[model samples]
Target: MPEILIAALSPVGHFGPLLNVARGLVDRGERVTVLSGAAHEREIRSVGATPATLPPQGDLDLDLLEPDSGREEISGIKRLNFDIVRLFVAPMPHQAKALAELLTQKRFDAILADYGFFGVLPFVLGERSARPPVLLFSTTPLMISSRDTAPAGLGLPPSTSTFGRLRNRALTLLSQKVLLRPAHKAANCQLHRFNSPELPTFLLDVGVLADRLIVPTVPEFDYPRSDLPANTRYVGMVHPSPTMRFRPPVWWQKLDGDRPVVHVTQGTVDNSDPRRLLQPTIEALADENVMVVATTGGPHVSELGFPIPHNAYVADYLPHDLLLPKVDVMVTNGGYGGVQRALSTGVPLVVAGNTEDKPEVAARVAWSGAGIDLRTGDPTAKAIRAAVREVLGDGRYLRRARELEAAYAQRDGVAEIAALIDEVIGERAVAP
Candidate 1:
């Protein structure tokens, strides 16, 4: 059996696409082992792969990932850069060592890793003899250097102005030098005992070094840039496993009346102040002719102390595939998965909250004319109401979303990704 190791950081929202890919590889007669945090063990085992647990290095909190937070008291882009380096970049050595030990025990043929796990590549791919060919997987849209696409995680516009160009150049330089370079060096140094080659930027050094770069998004949803590396290929979106089966409550039938249904969910992680947003949303649409379906994702739905309007249904989670088709508008925190789901269903969006990569995703949603990206701070009830009304009243957004949906439907994501994996295995002769 050809053995493959799949490495992921944690069991958060990003794990789904990578898990789906691993499951596909396992189904293809490859022996697959998953290296991830303890929280993900059950999820890994559910896919019929052996789970190798990494020790708890405290909790993997998303708050630590946001650059804007804590900046008011603290100043300087360099300080922010140092914080990111300390929190994320400095952990590469420990992660690389753990992954290296796991690989030695299993003697795997190749590695399939998520972008966050790119840190492990220098250790796994550096030494010619001990090293195995690698494949990189990105759950989100692949970023290209040339076109603005939607701004890499910020809402910054595409630059022609000197200041914008300088800002862009500085950010890119800082990312390459202070962040990626050090992590790559750390991993290479850890593998120096085996005479591993020095690595460059994790994306280019390992991506070019890798046999293939598998992006789990379709070309239709994201336009390909001419500057994309030769090794890169878009494999379409990996449909996530349904977390829980949803049976619409009896009151769901009442929602089928005259009003159009609007679905609102802030996704799992980025909804820290769900009540702050959800309450206002419920109140804003109370007198309106729209029916709202709000998902609190297991948090207290009544935290804002607002009365639940008769027209709104509140729940912890809703099966988006089932619910999206029935919804005319989606209000969310701009999680890529949920946004893509809504777009696939031909429903327009009202995006709020600028956490994580959300501001960038929200900007894309607005730019595409498929939705409105409301500002996170001071997102008053009036703004939510106006955005909701605009999406529902204007037919253009729906038309644009339907256009994207047609494009999405034409692409067979699963088949395309499966074919790519088959080609990779065939090229390397790695099979169980």
Candidate 2:
């Protein structure tokens, strides 16, 4: 059996999906060891994988992955970029050292890594033939540079006209150099330390170098990219094995009511303040003819002091696998994973987010005609109400969403990814 080493950049949103990959590999009879921040050890072992700790390094503050709620959208996004480099990218030397030590202790067949896990770059780019092949897994929409897509984070709609194409190319170049400047430099510095060839473009080149770039979303949902490398693969929605731990709330029957069900969430990572989306959405639909279901992402639901509307139900968490199909529209802070879950179930979205990769996700939601983009992480109830109504009143959004659902049909992303791991490692180990 070929042992696989999986590294998630941080213990935030990135680890969960990587854990799913670990579980899939274990189910296929492979020994998988996951390395991430100290915070995720239990979750890793929960999925039946050995846990490896990313030693505490002064270079990182993983909590900074979710900002403490107070910056203008543009500035917040800029700060987020720097934090990503610090929280995940800048810690490369330490992670690489730890990984190198682990490699010294045991021989592994392949490495599976999250996109932001810059620590693996050195080993991946190393000239040594002894190194195992590495696969970069993306939990979000594919962010690589492409002829058909605008530069990520700008959230600009994909342009089709000659002028639009020129705009995309120009913006892509400018944004890549200017916005990603710190990350590019940080990545190369690590390369120098590890005696690897410096990457020309930090992540884009990483995509090029990966043995396989596996994305969780279906191809139809993403902007077309004819130039996407042969190593890149679209494995649709690598959803985790559902524990069914989240029971429906007492008011769960509200979903079966006459009103359309609108599910609003800020997801887990950035949901520190419910006002970000939950409160606003509940308030927005307080008087609407819709049933509002809000999840606090955990036990914090009881701490919400604001009065919930009569037509709404609030819970600590709800299983998206079970809840999404019943939702007519999802108002979210544009978490890419949650958005994809909503899209897979043919639920339209009203996306409101700006920090991290959310603006890009929101942009795609609008571009796909699957929903409205409120354009800021801190949208008001008025803004949310308007977007929610737009998604609900229009048949176009529903139609487009169902089209994506059709496109997602029959694609088992996790199994394919597991098989791809086998292919890369040449283990050919069938799942027992």
Candidate 3:
């Protein structure tokens, strides 16, 4: 069995799935060690894998997971742009040094990393002659088409005009040039320590750096891109971490006795003001018409201190797979995992908030008409009510979500992804 090293950064959300994938690999007799933030050491160790600590860097603090801490503040767009830089450039050298040392001493047979760790690519590629193969993993949808390509999964009419295609191409180019260049430079400089040549561009650089890319989302939830290179593949969603388990309370049985249910959760990182978001939602639908199951994810729940309505059940978390099948609509803060899980269960959504990748995910949701996306800056009860009504009344959103779920059901993500990793290792072992 091959030994693999997995690198994960930031919020435990992304790390959870990767750890599960590693555990699966371990069950197959492969040895896996995870290099992650100190905050996740316990979670990684719980999966029966070894953990290596990453060197301290700006923003490594796990406290960012807390709501409204104001550790750093910027407009959503600016933050996204800055994050691209930090992921690709600013932290590359430090990450490369740590990874290179690991490779030389530990002799890892393969490397698996979250997509944000693009800086590690050069080191992996530079040592191709001596190092084992590397694979890139993504927990979100990798948009393959130009922005103008009418996003996939959204049931919107396709843009057929030449102008539309041109617009998308222009946006794509601008993002690459203005937002991605500096990040590439920073990343290239980090790799330069290993005596590697400078990268041409962020797009081309990362592309050349990765041998194979495995995205955790199924293609049905995202549009299929004909334009991507052959190395990219869409694997299914990784199961949530075993450490963070949720079981429905006994009262949940009574709550779901008869009525159609709506599962509402703001997720951990984005639930900054769950009462602000959920209280209105509860008020709008509280006539016992449909059971509303809401979770504020701990912090937000405590902050709200509001009384839970008779028809609405409030908690910190719910076993998604257990609750989703009974749910008719899922209201969330545009979390990728929650949205994907809801869709997988054939439930429609009403997504709010624009934090991080929420806007992009919201845009896709709106485009697909699988649900409604409300602006978080000024989301009113009326808007939330309207979105909820549309999803429940129209029937189209639920139908589309079910269609996507059927497609996703055909593929088993965990097993297929494990097989791919095994293949990469097997091919390398026999290469000589």
Question: lDDT tens string, model 1, 329-408?
Answer: 99887888888888877889998866556776677688677899896733778999999999888999999999878767
Q: lDDT for model 3, please.
A: 0.70
Candidate 2 residues 1-432, lDDT tens each? 888999885645687787888888888788989888787888888878998888787124645554463323346436756666666677888888888988998888888988777778887777546688789998667788877678777788776778888888888887777777766777787679878888855554577787889988887777877687798988888776875566566777768867899998888878778877888889989999999888988647679879987989888788888888789999999988899889888999999998778988998889888999988989998999988888889999999999998888769888888888878777323322
> 307, model 2: CA deviation in Å?
1.8
* TM per candidate: 0.84, 0.92, 0.87
lDDT by residue (3-118, candidate 3, tens digit) is 88988765656676788887887778888888877777887788788888777662244443344644267644455545556544566666777787787778787888877665
Best candidate, TM-score: 2
Query: Relative to the true structure, how large is the alpha-carbon lDDT of every model?
Result: 0.69, 0.81, 0.70
| Model 2 CA deviation exceeding 4 Å by range | 10-12, 58-60, 65-81, 427-432
Clashing pairs counted in every model: 1, 0, 4
lDDT of 1: 0.69
